[model samples]
Target: MSDTEGVEAEVAGAEAYAEAVDVLGPFNGPVLLAPVTHNPNNGVTDGVWDVTAGDRAAVLKVLTRSKGTTGHWAASDDPRHWNYWRREADVHVSGLAQLWRPYGIRAPRLLACVERPDGDVALWLERVRGGPGTRWTVRQHVEHLRRLGVAQGAVGETADRPWLSRRFLREYIAGMTPGQELLDDDEAWRQPLVREHFPAGLRHDMVRLHHDRDWFLQIMESLPRAFCHLDMWPANVRSDGPGSALFDWAFAGDGALGEDLGNYLPDSVFDLFVPAARLPRYAAAAYEAYLHGLRESGWKGDEHLVRLAVCASAVKYDWLTGMMLARAGEAQVDYGGDRPVSPELRYRERGSTLAFLAGWASEARDLAPRLGFPEAPSGR
Candidate 1:
């Protein structure tokens, strides 16, 4: 068969396997049977099956070639991208599992990595025992933040690929800004929302941000590097009680220690439907808990600097928000999951939330002296 035909056949085989597993039980009896759904909303690449047969329960994730590389898959063209994708999948599952198991951080236990006859990959994992019981409470979310902090600290210096280092974020921000016009033209659907939140003046600067790589690199070198989940939002985080399980580690890499902390605080606060007024209190507590975990994990640095680095990371997201908004008119906005991209659903409705974070940053700045950090630096 030609390579194209071979890949097509592989895709068909994967689908057939999924169907057979759902109808029957395990193929060989030791395995389980379950129906898997393709998560199109996120990336639409893989099918996620909720597999259960008696005491052994797991999620069987089947992947053929991806429509693109928001997640892991072999691209027939580029050998490097192919290697990077596969290496990442194997390393992330095994590495984080090894790192977190000792510290009691919850993650799916990796069962097996099955390479298909036609060069596709399937990852079988122990399913999370129980998902968060209801909508997460504010306190529960705060505790989850603390746990994430512990996990981050525990992940210190484990994987040291410099390409995934501080420079990666810096360069990414620089590259995306100039492409704003293309994004705006291609992704016009987001214009209303982007224009509503972002002023005209700032929008121009969005494109010019490509010129300011120096600031990004300066910030990068100053920040202490730690192992980051790189995708630590509420969705990837599952919880029961104060305990939580973190999944989806395709982007796991070394990053500034507080990157995930800043990412988590806003996500947990917003997604849990926490009251606006109470957000500050919860944030402060999560920040404190995260610092404590970092200290416990043997980090030797000025804690205040780390906090500032975390805040600046928010600026990175601010840049990303503009980019996504610019592309809102595109056929799909890639949110980097198993599903196809959709609208900026979370940020669209939560203007108040972003305002809250800005306010929290201002307050945090005022309290910086008392907290042993200098006043917030000024720049756009």
Candidate 2:
């Protein structure tokens, strides 16, 4: 069956629920299933459901190769593709997700990974109960970053897995087509939120950041490599017992030593989980804590190189400002929903984040020459 048809049938079928029970097992009563709302913009995910049978509970996630309505959301059959549709299932079935247990972080336990008669793959996972990362205090956020450092440091320069994503930053960034014309359009920038939060100076820096994208990518490639959870961010993590439980292994793959921390710090503020005002304080503390974790794991790399990678990693979001500008005239929505939100609030929060990332771009330029990668002649 085609992915679209399969998804429609599975969501309406009793067979899917029965299959869940068969895979999850030992239920005292019939399972109750309820559809869980998730980000609908991503085309590959068929559906997520909350499954419960008496005292037992699990999360059921269905994955498919559906392209949805946009070229950017298309999934790939290639194992190395950044959005390979089967990567998450493979991570669970092969127990690769559990590899970081010794370092105090782990993916939720996989109760079952079922290949359905249709094209979709169903994953039944443990329902971890804890405060979401969005609600985490600064101290908790730093500790999680430390644990992430320990885990990635321990996996330093390991043999590549065919199913693990490769060149993720480059490939993912290439998929975005942010509106360049909107960047310089005075009318677009004059939107109330943009005018107030994204000033002329910050806008120029962001444009420079976009211009230096290729240069930043080159520097990141030259840095020390590690196995990374490329989507490490507030929404995908939670406090679970003594350690943390990370979700969404779809983008797990190879990355520079400090890339995950780079992504995490900005992401925390981008979604307004942590306020943009705390970014500087969090950046300093998190970097130090991450380095401490790396040292604990016997990684003796130069601190400056790691710092370079962390700062240069801002290239991953170079398209964000233009994208935001393109959408500035539209009715704004909350991060995870279609619910209408005030454009003023949305732009204010994300504009601050863009300003911070623009600073990282400047820092990356300074750090590059010191590390022997001289700045390329600017095309701008």
Candidate 3:
């Protein structure tokens, strides 16, 4: 059989079905498997399927290191790489995902972690039926951020794990080959969304931000560190009853105390889940709530320091505007789907987010000196 046919046969085999049923509980009826659409950019994921046997359900995520194609952001064999192929499996097996239950955050329960003869790992996880983050209210977003702060604060110092990602932001940013030329292309900025949302001042700020990316990375290195869910964005989170459950632990590691909040705020609007106009209000409230949670967890650090880190964390997206400009002429697709979306809508939403992040970049520069980093980096 061909490779594709072989994979299909393995996935449909009775042995795998029985294993899933064993962990998912005995079923009185036949088992069914349906493929689920997930992020396809990650090369490690062989497939993801929703497994159903009678009333029981589970998600079977097959991870393999054999994929031939490799995007710049694709999974790496290096254990400390930001997108390590086996990180999520290690996270579930080590019970790290359950450590934050007291802080009102958790990961989906692991039903089984099966190692296959073909050098793949099949992660059987409880199918959480929570509401998608796109449907979450502003209050829900704030609460989730606060909970994340509490959890990170409680961790104090992360244990030295060989597999934990190091220099994640720096390395991940370096991987992206952004279209730097588009930053100065006047015509690129003339696109409808860019013209309306990104003014000349914002454009200038974004360009400077891209140039000073290393400066912000240096500043983050000087700040207090904590265990962080480095990829805590809307699409990776879900409302689990009254609390939240985060998925995709591929980038979990040490980071600046408030770095997760920084990622969360901009990402909420990046895909238009939250309106761009409400960003300031959300940022203000979420920052305060996160601070409160940190304090409640016995953290007594300087709030200004956290604010600076949050603002400077905008450096993480320094390449995004350039990438958007390069793609501005192309037809847009909905996030994680093949469905076509209006280019105008896509650019308008994402451009507004870029403008907002540019403001944060400026704030980071201003805040840096006050935090005692008086010598600005070469780009500034």
Candidate with the greatest TM-score versus the true structure: 2
User: Which of candidates 1 and 3 reaches a greater TM-score?
Assistant: 3
lDDT for 34 (candidate 2)? 66
Model 3: how far is 336 from its true place, Å?
A: 0.9
If candidate 3 were superposed on the true structure by all CA atoms, what would the RMSD be? 4.4
**Per-residue C-alpha lDDT of model 2 across residues 104-194, encoded as one tens digit per residue:** 9998899888887878899888877877777889999999989887887787865677999999999999988767667778887787767
Q: In model 3, what are the clashing residue pairs, if there are any?
A: none
Q: After superposition, how far is residue 290 of candidate 1 from its true place, in Å?
A: 0.7
Q: For every model shown, what is its TM-score relative to the native structure?
A: 0.67, 0.93, 0.92
lDDT of 3 by residue, 269-316 (tens): 887779888999999999999999898888888989999989989998
lDDT of 1: 0.53
Deviating ranges (above 4 Å) for candidate 2: 1-12, 28-30, 67-69
Regions of model 3 farther than 4 Å from truth: 1-15, 377-380
All models: lDDT? 0.53, 0.81, 0.80
Query: Which regions of candidate 1 deviate over 4 angstroms?
Result: 1-45, 53-56, 63-84, 159-168, 171-179, 182-214, 240-242, 269-278, 298-300, 323-349, 356-380
